[model samples]
Target: MAEVRAEMVANVWKVVVNEGDQVSDGDTLVILESMKMEIPVISEDDGVVAQLKVAEGDVIQEGDLIAVIE
Candidate 1:
């Protein structure tokens, strides 16, 4: 299993995947807004999306666990 984590503190602007979804490397999993910039979080490995730990408008800190892929 692999964990997708926040690289910096930000507000979650969108979630682009759901549980059980098949994902590939480089798929955009979420979009976050910070300092007026839109930051896209992408999958680093091919896997099924096992869990989503945040939602739109949610605030996340650096290193926060955002999702699990397996």
Candidate 2:
């Protein structure tokens, strides 16, 4: 399993994938808003999304868990 994490502090603007959704490496699982810029939180593993740890409109910090791909 691969644990996706936030790289910086941001608000979760959108959640594009759900649990049990199939995903590939580099796919955007969620979009984050920081400093008026939208940053896509990408999945690094080619597998099913086992867990979604954040929701839209959530304020998250760096190193926060985003999702788990397995």
Candidate 3:
């Protein structure tokens, strides 16, 4: 399993994948808004999304768990 974590504090602007969704490396799983910029959180490996730990409009801190892939 792989844990996808936030690299910076930001508000989750959009969730692009849901639980059980298949994703490839570099696929954007979520988009976060910070300092008026849109930052895309991407998958680091090819796998199925096992969990989603955040939602749109949620504020997340750096190192916070974003999703789990299996």
TM-score of each: 0.97, 0.97, 0.97
> What Cα-based lDDT does every candidate model obtain?
0.96, 0.95, 0.97
Which lDDT tens digits does candidate 1 get at residues 1-70? 9999999999999999999999999999999999999999999999999999999999999999999999
- Which stretches of candidate 2 lie above 4 Å from their native place? none
Candidate 1: give its CA RMSD in angstroms: 0.5
- Please report the candidate that would top lDDT against the real structure: 3
Clashing pairs in 3: none
Give the range where candidate 1 is weakest over 10 consecutive residues by summed lDDT: 45-54
Model 2: which residue pairs collide?
A: none
| Candidate 2 lDDT tens digits, 1-70 | 9998999999999999999999999999999999999999888879999999999999999999999999
Model 1 clash count equals 0
Which segments of candidate 1 are over 4 A away from where they belong? Answer: none
Error (Å) of candidate 1 at residue 33 is 0.6
Error of 1 at 45 (Å): 0.7
Worst 10 residues of 3 by lDDT: 38-47
